[model samples]
Target chain A: MSRIPEETLRVADRLAAAMAREMRDDRVAGAALPLALLAALLARALYAPDLVVLGSLGLPLAPSAWWPGSGFRLSLARAEALALRHADGRFALEDAFASVFRGRFAIWISPAQVDATGSANLSAIGDWRRPKVALVGSRGLPDDAGHIPMRYYLPRHEPRHLPAAVDFRSAPGRTPEDGRRGRRRGGPEVLVTPLGVFRFRPEGVVADSLFEGVTPEEVTRRTGFPVTGLPEAGRTPPPTAEETAWIRRLDPFGIRALELLPPREARLAAAAIAEAEGEGM
Target chain B: MLASLTDVAARVREASKAGRLVAFGGSGLHRKPLRAAEAIAEAAVPDLRLLAPLGGPEVDLLVLAGLVRRVVFSYVGFEFLGVAPAFRRAREEGAIEVEEWSEFAILAGLRAGVLGLPFHPLPGPATGDLARTAPLAEVRSPYAPHEPVAVVPALAPAVAIVHVPFAREDGTAFVPGDPYADRLVGLAADELFVTCDELVGPGEVPGPALFLAAEVTGVVPAPGGSCFTASPPFADLDVRGAIDYLESVEARLARPSARAAPGRAGGGRGR
Candidate 1:
């Protein structure tokens, strides 16, 4: 932020307003606003692509509506949706995750599991209700693109300050069964819970806490998901509002991939869309 | 062969039979009923089986009205159609078969049967548990590496009825986008009949190249069925309607298929 030239800064009105609206807590409001402003300002200068790091806010917020295991119960339904629609394997999941972990994909786990991770996983970027992210297996987007809609599910708990347990299936990496069956080839590093934020490292371990603004405790309390640990201390900033706006205007920045929403939600949304479409309105 | 959306609707309505089921969809998907193509579906599919991937409130009127019987699909299309009470009832009663199928497999299966394959191996991403849960993915040689065939048992209908914006006299048809699955249904059918809003010759279309292959056997010239599919030259989509349709289909698709041998029985023969 210090290096950014003053003239290059994009207005932070939308970002600021969104933050203000999203975070009702005053205590954290000051810091979040400034951080967002600074990051957005800095993003004006940095080549967003060169910015290997991302300060994803899908992370825990002071008052977030998302959590880790929120998708856990919904996993069955979500998994069912994916299985049903994806059995043929035409579209790719935004997140390369296996929902059941050790079991087959069901719509619900025990209520106990839901209590473990609190977030609902509805906090995907932009308007995407069921977001998916993937590697640029193809060539990267245009150089100026800002965000790659990489949908990852950070566990509710990390080794330490973990406020939430994350779902890794939402990240990179192929599930074991998928590997055995040769379905999804690999696994994801970081995760984007409806609440928590994460980033991947070259080392393969998902370093937590990519959303610089919110804390695990705050996020956990807000989203009811326990997000543990910050990234190895120095996380890269996210694209500022200017960069985001620029990318939106100049390029199709985000990855179009996303995973299925919890079954109930997905069913509802798809039904709404389908029904509306069927009506021919 | 030349017909309009309304003409197509009459054909579909005529194709309906009691206690018999037929799958209906187009390459151009729609969630709303206002579009002429979807209207064709509404007009044709009601009081019969609306066999789709899913259902929702959107088509509840169709469902509850007893106009729609059972819907089979992956997701509820309620949002697309408009919320309805009938679909919900069907779901509660365990009437719809929502077994999932991969987007590709759905198309490929139809294609394979049309192309003269017993089953086409559909080895791809099974996002939800539909592959294991759905009957569509159950086959002797599903995605076998050697053949990699997705056993698309011939989805031959007593009548492969479709509503397009354009129906040509030479059995050529046109719809929006590359309606690949429609082509599959067109080819692997005992008969391919169509209804449309307008009838056009090869001269009316961009070129003869745009017409589907010969498999689109019978071109029944009818108009006004372009409501669901967004058959171009007649209409485009409002997107909101598409969203609503997505939701309805999602709901209707909630029912899983009773998994059996993929092609245990069917109207058409597989390669």
Candidate 2:
């Protein structure tokens, strides 16, 4: 019944495939990403009126693609202008925790590393004093996870990220002993990776479902901790053709393609050094 | 009265020497009055403590210049780029004192200050490292002693600097995009200085009034003041320029005499 284009659907399909699981609620707040964009479109398609998507500064209101190395840009200039003109619609970063605490707010966060228990690290790798790599420091993950329910999104499912324990507990997940704390302040509920969907359980993380063409062994191999209570290997439901077409209509520029590749590879490939070397020769 | 950018910076420098705490507006590269802050750093005033809700290049530049003695902030990093090199180096060397608060705590502290409240209570477990080091104190709820709450002390900075798109001679400032915590910073500070791309008459300013003239101590017109940060209507974030600045900073840090190159601090334009 929808008149959405086929090309748009293909792009949305890739995004929806990466973010396969359904959210508990239609409303969410998070930094802009390909998966987050897909979730927004999915929420809209479901006719959810409470859909409120909050983006960080300069993040596009809709799905966008960064030029190979230029970084993210608003896909539509008009949309960018509109967003700027209605700037009051955007929430203040300082009020982020207050919103989470006020309740009926769900957040989808992507951290550098996540452990089996749903604990996350966005600060650093290795020692805290002299880290092997220092990432953007913990912004609101600690308070958000400590106060409200959160979901995780990992575009690249790798062993390093799905570690047994995070190098830093930027945000502590729910544990058996943390029942009282968890009840007072909700914790992470589910994790959606490129390969599959996982739910954090008191026992450990259990596989909710695996993406099509992805094997249980592959998921287990990529994860650092043993995935307990594997749900009878079910296929991640694919987005319908109509849904994909509608998403493409929403994002005409195929911005979702940028996320299809690993960030490290993309950065290196788009590095100024490589471009300069080519130009010099 | 409209003041020159240098005069504004001089005011900040003078205040810093008195060991006053200063707050800065914006997150990442949005609405940061970096040029004026850099000017303050270049002045090399001592005993200055900074209170930033979120940190970026402005904080890094100050740390690199050894102008800041203490900093109260939630996080300090270059966002997706990497850790703020100067902040990391300073922290590792124990060159500066840090009062780490969670992002919410900083905001709540400022809000409490604006409202003239003693402290704002945050609901959560206050057992984290930041909660231990910061000014947050645990107290039994008066309504329910069983319910524990973390209360963050109110923050009243001596001065707050923010960048806006436009301003009037009377000191009213307008922000084209999200004001973030600029308004809160303005209200919480004893004195507020706003740097804008354009200076106009009272009625000519566009957008909502982000900072009232009564609270604003001064307004200075400095085009492209945010530079690498988005000034909007004026210019978008100069990402290429930011990348260039980051590369230069990295190169300088990698040099053998990197520590001796403090003279180069505040030499470059805002980015």
Top TM-score hit: 2
**Candidate 1 local accuracy as lDDT?**
0.33
**What's the DockQ for every one of the candidates?**
0.08, 0.31
Candidate that scores best on lDDT: 2
Interface RMSD of 1: 15.8
Q: Please report, in order, the local distance difference test score of every candidate based on alpha carbons.
A: 0.33, 0.66
Docking verdict class for candidate 2 = acceptable
Model 2 regions more than 4 Å off: A1-21, A28-38, A45-49, A55-82, A85-91, A94-98, A127-132, A181-183, A238-281, B46-48, B80-82, B92-95, B127-129, B260-271
- Candidate 1 CAPRI grade: incorrect
Q: Per-residue lDDT tens digits of candidate 2, residues B1-271?
A: 6877677667677667778778888766556778777777666666679887877878877787777789887777654444677777767666778776777778888989899999998767753345544787888889988877889999988888898889998988887677677778888988888988888775685876787788798988887777666667775554445555566776776774765233232322442
lDDT for position B134 in model 2: 77
The C-alpha TM-scores of every prediction are 0.50, 0.83
